[model samples]
Target: MSQDLPTTSYALLGLLSFGDDLSGYELKQRADRTLRFYWVSPAMSQVYTELARLTKLGLVRAREDTTAPTRSTRRFQITAAGRRDLQRWLSSATVEFPALKHPIALRLLMGHLAGPETSVTLLEDYLGLLAERRAELQAVRDSLIVDPHSPVDRFRYPRMVADWGLDYYESERAMVVELIRRVAATDT
Candidate 1:
C-alpha cells in the first residue's frame, strides 16, 4: 500500500489479514456482516476494484480460480507488505471524533419554524427507531452470551466495539426522550 491510501483501502487490508484467504465475494459478505455496522464497508464492485489495485501494488496476492469455464474469480490474501502497512497504520493513531449527521437532530435544530409539536413528533419517531436498533443489538448480545465460544467471548476487541455501539444507542435513546419531554413541557 502507498503512504496515502484511503482508510477504505486499509480497512480491506485489515480484513484480508484476519487469517484466511477470501474471494472478492466472501470479502464483501464479511464486510457487510461486520464492518458495515462500525466501519467502512465497500460495495461488491468496490471490493473487486480494490483487490485489483492492491494486487497491482503488491500489497495483496490474488489467485485465479478456473473451476467454472465461463467465469473466473480471484481469492486474495494480504501480502507481508500489506500486513506491515496495516500494522504501521494501527500503531499510529489519529483519533476520529464521533460525528453525527442525524436527520432528527437537523430537524430539531429548525423545529422552531414548525413549533414544539413538530419537534416532539420527530423525537418520538427517532426514539422508536433507536429503540428498535437497541433491540437488535440486544439480540446479538444475547446470542453471544448463549454461545460460550463466540467471537466476542474469545476476542476482547470485538466486545469493546459492540459495547461502544450499544452504549451509543442507549445514550441517544435517553437524550431523545429527554428532549421530547422538554419540548412538550413548553405547552404545559
Candidate 2:
C-alpha cells in the first residue's frame, strides 16, 4: 500500500499520527512549522490533494465538522491501515543519501565568471541569511526542549534533528566565511 502512495502521503500520515484530527489547513500549517526546516512543505492545494488520495486509499478517514457555525470543514485522521503502512515504510524502506543542491555552492563554482567581488558579496549575504534561518530553527528547538528530563518526550527525536540542523548551519557558515576570505585574498 505504501508503494502506491507518494512520500507526501506518508508525511501527512505521520502528522496525523500525532493524534490531532486536523483540517487540511492545519496540516499545511504544521508542515510549514516543522517540515520546512528539512523537507519541502507542500502547498495548500497539494495538502488537500494528498488528503483526498489518502482517504480514498482507506489510509485516512475524514468527517465534516459543522461546528464552525459558518460552514463545514473536513477534519482528517489516520486509520489503522495508515499506521501499519507508515511503520512498514519506516522500518523497511531503503534510505538514500541526502542530495545536496546548494545554489550558493553552484554559483561559487562559477566564480571566475562573476569575479571575486561578486563572489565575496554573495557569501557575505548568505552569512546573514544563514543566521536568520539558524535563529528560527533555534526557536523551534527551544520549544521542543520543554521537558528535557523526560525520556519519553514525544519531541525528543525532533529536537535532536533540530540540533543536527543547527550544527549543519554553523558548519556551512564557517565554510562560507573561509570562502569569502579566499575570494577577498584573490582580489588583491
Candidate 3:
C-alpha cells in the first residue's frame, strides 16, 4: 500500500478489483483484448512483475494453484486495501494527459520522405490494423449489450471510456481515408 504506485500498478489493481480471480495469463489476455486499445498495455513480463510487486505490497492476494497441471500457477485478486487505493486514484484529478506513441502518426508526419505511393501503402496497412481492432471492440460491445448480466455489466464507467475509444478510432480512420484520397489524387 504505497501512496505513489505507478499508473500501471493501479491499472492492474483496477483489473483485479473486478473480482474475476484471474491468473497472470488471463489478466494479460483481458488487458490485450480490452484495455490495450486505449490504455497502456504492459508486456507479459511487466504483468508478472507487477503481480509480484503487488503481492509483496499486500495489495493483492495470490494463491498458488496446486491442482493445476502447470507448475507455479497463481491466481490473483485485489485486497481490500488495493481496492481503496484504486478508488482513491480514480477520484484524483488527472496527473497528465495520455502519452501518444503512435507509429502511424510519426510515419504520416514523415510521409514526404517515402513519397505519396509509399504513404498510401502505409495508410492501407494501418487501415487493416484499425479494422481488426475496431471489429474486436465492436464484437465485445455487442456481446455486452446482448448479455446484460455478463460480468462486464459491472464496468459502468469503463464502458463510457470504451465508447470514447470507438469514436476516436472511427474518427481517426475517417481522417486517414481522406488523407489517402488526397494523396492518391495528387499522385495521379
Query: How well is each residue in 84-156 modelled by candidate 3, as lDDT tens digits?
Result: 8788888984778778888987987997798889989999999999998899888766654434667556766
132 Cα displacement, candidate 1 (Å): 3.2
**Model-by-model lDDT, in order?**
0.81, 0.89, 0.85
- Best prediction by lDDT: 2
Candidate 3's C-alpha lDDT?
A: 0.85
Tell me the spans in candidate 1 whose CA falls farther than 4 Å from its real position.
Answer: 66-71, 139-154
* lDDT: the better of candidates 2 and 3: 2
Writing each residue's lDDT as its tens digit, candidate 2 over 53-76 gives 889888899999989979999999
**Number of clashes recorded per candidate:** 0, 0, 0
Candidate 2 segments exceeding 4 Å error: 146-152
25 Cα displacement, candidate 2 (Å): 1.4
Output the better candidate (1/2) by TM-score: 2
Q: Identify the leading candidate in terms of TM-score.
A: 2
lDDT of 1 by residue, 110-161 (tens): 9879799888988898888888877766655555443465654443566577
Q: Flag the better candidate by lDDT, 1 or 3.
A: 3
Ranked by lDDT from best down, the candidates are 2, 3, 1
User: Residue 120: error of model 3 in Å?
Assistant: 1.0
| Span of 10 residues, lowest total lDDT, candidate 3 | 143-152
